[model samples]
Target: MSYQENYIKQLHTLLRLVTDSVEGYKSAAEHVDSTEYKDLFNNISRQRESIAAEFRERISGYGGNAEVESPDLMASLHRSWMGIKTAMTKKDDQAVMESCRNGDQALLDAFDDILQGDLLNNADLKTFIMDQRLKVNEVFLDLDDRYFKLFKKDPSI
Candidate 1:
């Protein structure tokens, strides 16, 4: 593929992942019973919405069409699985938090892949991805710490 096409493809992939995150967090908010967790999930969903918007803008700037429709099927299935897991675990908050943590890790992994790949050689795009990745990593760390504390497990383990 040409350079432009390759970059556009990368942007689309990031866009899809961010969109999936938004939906995933929204689903988490619905599955959890705690008001605090619900609010947290909703807030994160909003943050991801903003990030997805930036991605859309960037894709459009490159003359590529952004997929503004529903997130992909995998994300849908994962969200459904989360709901089922929550039900099976009797609405356990820890289970929901763990799923959220996993989703966040997946997003971070996508960022790492793009950053380490040759297709993202543009300095401006690189900076944008790095900044976004840092924000996502911070969220992941917070969720992970909370998970360990809630389960009374040492993080070092």
Candidate 2:
């Protein structure tokens, strides 16, 4: 596969994870304790869904399968971890803090891979990837700040 082809496959995997993460977050919002956390999860879930739509379209435009070719291993694992943490917290904030850290790490890993890879020759995809990286970084940073404020120890973020 061309680098672009690999990227397309990777992106489809991302979309699949995003879809599952969105669903998980939505469930968290409805079943979680705090209204603030609920709202945050809901908003983030919607944002992820929107990103997934864009990814699907971009993949299809490239003559690739847009319907999520593979599972997002990291995100799926993160979701499971988050659920366990949610159950363990019992209204404490540590679990959510752990979740934030894991999410930050996942986003960072994803964007770092995209950033280090050579995609500049593909103008359209390169631009899109750059934009997504910036967006993902922004979200990660914001979540890190929130987690720091809530947890106040910087566990691993």
Candidate 3:
């Protein structure tokens, strides 16, 4: 693929990931019994929605179509998360937090893949990606801390 085509595809992938994140967070919010956890997930879901919308607008500016649905990769990830939730006692906040930690790590991995790729050669795109990456990193760390506080162990291990 041409550089432009590749760039647009990556953007679409990121957009779809953000959309999937919103849906995942919403479902996670519903699964948790704690009010604080519910609110946390709900707020993150809204933030992901905003991020997805921004991605769509940016892709449109590049004369490309934004993805209307999550990509197969993210779709499978979502299904896997749902499966994990369904197989367990869903009322557990610790389980929900564990799911969140997994999701956060996945998201950071996605961001890292893009940031380390050629897509960042475009300065504007680079700035945007870096900014988003920082935000994702911050949230991931916060989620890790919360998990640690609840479980008394690092989730990354």
Best by lDDT: 1
Q: What is candidate 1's lDDT per residue for 1-157, written digit by digit as tens?
A: 8777878888888888889889899988988888999999999999999999899998898889987665656666777788888889887888999999988887888889888886556888888878888888988998998888886764443
Instruction: Please list all clashing residue pairs in model 1, or write none if there are none.
Output: none
1-157 per-residue lDDT for model 3 (tens digits):
8878878888888887778778788888888888999999999898888888888888888889976654548656764766577458746787777787787688778878987899767989878877877777887888888887985554554
lDDT of 2 at 126: 71
> Which lDDT tens digits does candidate 2 get at residues 1-157?
7887877866675667567767766756755677887788788787878878888899888788787655677777887777777777664554664575577577657766765666655777778867766765776677677766764556553
User: Considering summed lDDT, which 10 consecutive residues are worst modelled in model 2?
Assistant: 89-98
For the record, the alpha-carbon RMSD of candidate 3 to the native fold, in angstroms, is: 3.0
TM-score for candidate 2, please give it: 0.82
Candidate 2 all-Cα RMSD: 3.3
By lDDT: ranked, best first: 1, 3, 2
Q: Candidate 3, 123: how far from true, in Å?
A: 1.5
lDDT of 1 at 75: 63
How does residue 9 of candidate 2 score in lDDT?
A: 68
Off by over 4 Å in 2: 91-94, 152-157
| TM of each candidate vs. truth | 0.90, 0.82, 0.88
lDDT of 2 at 145: 79
CA displacement after TM-score superposition, residue 49 of candidate 2 (Å): 0.8
